[model samples]
Target: MKAVEYRLPKEFDKSFIVFTERGTYFPCPWHYHPEYEFVLVNRSTGRRMVGDHIGYFDEGDLVFMGPALPHVWVNDAAYVQGQAKEEASAVVVHFVEDFLGKNFLSLPELEPLKKVLDLSKRGLVITGKTKKEINRRINGMIGESGLRRLSSLFTIFDILTHSSEYQPLASPSYMQHTQGYYSDRFSKITDYILRNFQHEISLNEVASEANMATTTFCNFFKEHYRMTFVEYLNTIRIGHVCKLLADSDENVVNIAYECGFNNLANFNRQFKRLKGMSPSEYRKTLELQSA
Candidate 1:
């Protein structure tokens, strides 16, 4: 699918830009650009799309996305419908790879930092102690100025470089192919899917959305997303299930149906296939972590 290219605000004269976002919802479409982005979701609950990966994210979601890695954070329907608080917030940092100077990362002493940057090409989700530390540093940068702000940014990078509490978001083979004619077409298809996935989605309807035949649409989707359309739909549904499992005491069968699954057996199978655990097991893990 095609993604929109987003241009970051260019008012900052420094090597990087840092800002805080507070809104009723995360306001961005599926998009990509040439900046390396480090974002911490201080508040919000939703699904995050990174490259071809679809998953759930909540408060304390810290992600480092390398240049041109397409991503977006879509708030749940509650936030969009104003049922939840209107003040969804985040701390975001955007910069180029050579923001420190072209030769900076090339230095032998900066090899570890370089490795972090390279690995971030697939997108990185910082977690555990590393995420907590980076969250503090990011919040600190919101008030600092001049060199102090820059120092806090570097401290985040150093911690990320040294810590193993992170996971890659996208596959190595995933690429942003949304250039020229296919851009809007892809965005329309993905948007429709994300909006209507809770109901019965017919391949015929989605193929028509792309102005392609069913066979052609299937081939095109698999080529670009590396999965069949049904697989991608299930990924999104399972992501929603995860958010409910962590945030609510909803019944598993109820959540499955609410997430658009038709039956418990199928939902359990797909959940286990994608997440490597049964729904109860996954919920237990979350409980253990919180305890």
Candidate 2:
């Protein structure tokens, strides 16, 4: 279950890359790379996992991710099972942080852009007018060539830098803890946890996977993830529970056990703790959104 390191397609002659993906569903697993990424989910709805943040993402979803942040958009079960009539599609832009130049972002004129890039370390979801404009620019970029494409990219960045309609997805603590430890072992551990979180998991077993003693593993996980193993596990589980609550008609009790909570009370407590609402309330919120 180790996360595969994704090597994005790079053209030696180009400074950045833009592409569109259309599929039955997003096929990549939990993975990360060194390039910054801006993604527009043109069509589809699903669970999106970025760093330690988990939530629902839908059509018109716009997210900007900094270098080395692990993420994936897992289309809902209906999309995967071909129950949905439309295919999933997205436009993704990838570039290095210094794609302009090593010192360009350090210039006084570009200071605001630098701040936007820094905030993107936690992942940024653009909304309101900015998202609509950026989406238009992204579509335009798909048809541009040479300097026009780069111009559109910079324009999008300028809008994002000036707009106040962006939300940071992950906690600052989560970003701080995970920034410097981009090793194979860390990737493997995350991959294992993401794949197995729906079932019972034990620290001892995970520690064995990392070849560390239980105590050492616990400390290591806390140091890097800024949360105890169990807390992180529950965060992931509750995230899935939120998705099911929003997207399906399954009973809350069944969803609770299906998401790995052993009992109703614990599920309700953890759901409230993480989301600040009961599962039923959260579902009602979704209904309101749909209405």
Candidate 3:
């Protein structure tokens, strides 16, 4: 999908931005910006889209995204409907690569940090111990200013440079295609799917949304997503099912149907295919972790 370019609020005297976002629900749509983003979700459960990658996110979710990498975190429907127990909140930091100076990262001592910045182009899923440590640093940046704030930002880079508990989202193919294609029609299609994935969606419906013939849309989708439209939609649905399994007491069959799966067997197969475990087993793992 084509990402809308969003301008970060300017703070001319400050080199970067660090703030806590709290609200009934996050208001940003699918968008991207020039500044790299460091996000730690302090309280929320929802779906996250970074480039073409679709996944579920819960409290403690952390990600690093480079400049112009499309992304958004949409709070689950409960949050939007004012039914969630906790308000959605996060610690967000934004800064450009040359925020210090164009020559700053070029320095010999900063080369490792510069390399990590480059890797952020595909977006980084900061996980394991690194995720916790980075969250601590990001939380510390709140209400901090002057040299202390800058130090916290640099400390995050230092930790990321030394940590391997991170994975790249957005496939390499999708990242390559993003350099050339930013279609509004694609954006319309993705926005439509995200809003309606809880119900059945058809090939013709999405193709028509793109204003393309089914054959043409298939080729176009493959070129951009490197997967069939159905593959992408199933991935999104399964991601939502994972969230429900972990966060609620919904029955597996009901969760599958609510997530747009009409067939229980197919839902089980797709869930296992995408998550490497059956839905019940996945929930068991989550319970064990909590216990």
Candidate 4:
């Protein structure tokens, strides 16, 4: 109950059109709401963890997650290493299930879209044509009124229902655990890791930062992230390393050291384990890649 951060639209009592200019830290600490969420990560690169899904996300990444589904966007970057952080802004809309109507979902007129929303109960990645329409409609919603706003949202689902371009990201029946004292503790812990992934961050230091016993911290951290504190630390670090691997001309050994990996051999091994490739191999693949 304490997990979901429900910051509804400014005039949510009358309408569900939610819009905000996200700061460098967009949605942090894997929070969800009781409302359906539509987010377009305009042009940006950041860490994305929703439900049990964990990966790096880039510009034009559009995602939808149902109520109380934990998700996060960890981007403290001014730039992707030497390159600039993405220039585009993030657009978001949040609405309750009942905002439209109960039968709106039950109607055969809405079945395909109904199934998509059902899939979105886990999470959804809307791409291709649907992404274009959602982006266009979200932009069009900036100055709309009561009925117009609802109709715009209806149009969004219209695209989702008809488009096979949409993909489900989180597994069916997925549930995210983000409750209690551990939530507060890891909010602090993960926030710190994002802020300091460029350097060495030890479990002891992180536990001290959270003011928790190491063993207790490890257990709690694992429960939330499904990995020990060190593992989560490496996750954040490895992401930065990938940013470097793809965006930088830096040497693999140097990038490893820069990302806080103490030993080169270990860096290569861990990068492979987490990224499915050696550092050099990852870098080579990114050579002149568009995204």
TM-score of each: 0.62, 0.64, 0.62, 0.55
* lDDT per residue as tens, model 4, 1-291: 123465654573565756744554554444667888887777677666665455577777788887777676655356434355444367788877776667666777866665666667657777787788898888778677788877888888877767778665543213322211134665677667767766777778888899988888788778867777667667666766765654467787888888788887777777788766677765554442222
Q: Point out where model 2 deviates above 4 Å.
A: 177-271, 275-291
Regions of candidate 3 where Cα sits further than 4 Å from its true position: 177-291
Best by TM-score: 2
Structure candidate 4, residue pairs in collision:
30-71, 79-85
Off by over 4 Å in 4: 1-4, 9-13, 79-88, 176-291
Q: Return the number of clashes found in candidate 3.
A: 0
Candidate 3, 15-35: lDDT as tens digits: 998878899988877688989
Leading candidate by lDDT = 2
lDDT of candidate 1 at residue 15, scale 0 to 100: 77
Error of 3 at 147 (Å): 0.5
Q: Least lDDT summed over 10 consecutive residues: which range in candidate 1?
A: 173-182
lDDT of 1 by residue, 38-148 (tens): 889988898787765667889889999888887878787788777886578999899987887888778887878876776687789888999999999998888888899
TM-score of 3: 0.62
Q: lDDT score, residue 247, model 3?
A: 57
Model 3 accuracy (lDDT, Cα): 0.80
